[model samples]
Structure formats: C-alpha cells, structure tokens
Target: MLETGQVISAENGQAQVHFKRTSACERCGACGMLANGQDMIVTLENTIEARPGDQVVVQMQTQGMLQASAIAYVIPLLLLIAGAVLGKLALAPLFAGVESDVVAAISGIALCALGFLGIHLLEPRLRRQKRFQLQMVSVHRAAQGREEEQIDKE
Candidate 1:
C-alpha cells in the first residue's frame, strides 16, 4: 500500500510522518498503533532529507503484507486442525467412544490459543525486519520551500 503524509518530525536521519486515514486503509488494521480512526504517525528513514511539514510518499510491500496475513491467520488454523486430529487419536482409546470428540475440540481450541500467544510474542522481532516495514521512497515537497517531487533510486 502507498500513502501520502507530511513529516511531523525529523531527527537522526529519520522522520515521523503523519498520514490521514483513507478509504484504502479502512480495512487494513495493520496500523493498529493509530490513536484514532483518522490519523497515523509512521517512523522511517528520511532518505530524501525531508523535514517537518514536507510531503512524502510511503511504500509498503504488498507481498510482505500477504505473508504476514498468512502467518497471522493460516498457521493457527493449521494448528487447530492438527491438534484436533491428534487429540482425537490420543483420547479415542482411553474414552472408547465416550465424549472423546468433545475433549478433542477443547484441545484444538487450547492449541490454537497457544499459537496466537506465540505469534504475539514474536511480533516485535518480526516487525523489526525491513521486508515487513514501510519505506519512504519519494518526497513531494521539502520543508525548504520546494514544491517539486524528488524521487530516489531504490
């Protein structure tokens, strides 16, 4: 996804850009850090030396987003199915056809919960990887009063 935002602050070769919420972002809860439904601040390297009040274009890799979606949604589903099958197999002999299915269902739910917990704990590290981050690739306007778009070679 691509977005246009103004740099709110700049320091240490990085900038925090403030972006207004758009219809394209409505379904994407990826920016969960948004304080409200209307705005978001993203910190990224200021490759174009953009300053506060500068307009910039941010690019987020669509492939990485899809991979993240799979990790967040599909893995737990697979775990649930595996847990159900394993639980049923293990309890079948013990229960001998008595409430084993119920026990398996509970085990599947518990296993899926664990999967979610694991993903939550690893999120910070996953987010630190560059492939999953948004990159500011162009400057629409510099704080120095230029109105030209500056495109950088990626």
Candidate 2:
C-alpha cells in the first residue's frame, strides 16, 4: 500500500524509512517481504534530495525482514540441535556406544558450518538488492505551488 513516511536515515544512496500502514498488507510474497508494520527501505534511482527528518510520501510493497533474518539463523540452529540430539539418541548406540555429547557436538559443528556457508553464498546478492537513494520529486509548499527541489549534497 502507498503511504506518506519520513526519512529516518540516509547515506550512500540509501534511506531507512518510517511510515504507517495505509492498508492491511497480507504480505503474500508479492513484496518479497512480510508486511507487519510501516517500516521499509526505499531505494532511489538517484541520490535523494531528502535529509533525515524530512517527510516524504513513499509507495512501497511490504515484505518480511524479520522473517528473512530469522529464517537465516533459526533453521540452521534447529538442524544443528536436532542433529546433536539424534546423534546422541540414535547413533551413539551403533559405534560401540560412542559418547552422545561428542557425536552431537560434531553434528552441530557441521550444521553450523553449512549454515554459515549458505550465508556467505547469499551475501553478495543480498547486498546488491539493498535500496539506492531516491531523487526528490517535485516539492510543494503552502506558500508556493509545485516547485522542483534540488540539493547540493557532496
């Protein structure tokens, strides 16, 4: 849904936005993130003429940042824990009663390694998807009609 929001932070062609939800977003993966509240990243085609604390109207699709970040960590952790548990309960009996703790530890370590590898593989693509700064559209003031606003940000 489209709504007006403020720029909370901006740097290096990116801005962190804060806005309220206008419509109930089901977050049906159309936005590629979960829609829970009114916080989002707006990437601009050019350097935005907005500074922090400026109110701008943002039209964005809602998505799940929390879910993505959580899935990145939690699934691997669960796999690790389960592997450790299973190693102790099921496999320990086969290897002349190998120590469950040791087996679990090894499995957990392997799972953690795999998880980290996945993160490393995805890091570059994720970075590329980060928002770029948006340019200023026309600015309107009560005293003035619609005028183009431009800023010289070095």
Q: Which is the leading candidate under TM-score?
A: 1
By summed lDDT, which 10 consecutive residues of candidate 2 come out lowest? 132-141
For candidate 2, the per-residue lDDT at 13 reads: 66
Candidate 2 residue lDDT tens string, 8-74: 6768866555545345443422222326544444544334456676665543323444445455668
Please give the range of 10 consecutive residues that has the lowest summed lDDT in model 1.
140-149
- Candidate 1 residue 150 Cα shift, in angstroms, is 3.2
All candidates: TM-score: 0.79, 0.44
In terms of lDDT, model 2 sits at 0.54
Q: What is the lDDT of residue 114 in candidate 1?
A: 94
Model 2 off-target regions past 4 Å? 1-62, 130-154
Predicted candidate 1 versus true structure: per-residue lDDT over 1-154, tens digit per residue:
7899999899999899988989877666666447676988778888788888778898889998888888888999998988888779886567665687887897788899999999999999999988788888887666355556666637
Candidate 1, number of clashes: 0
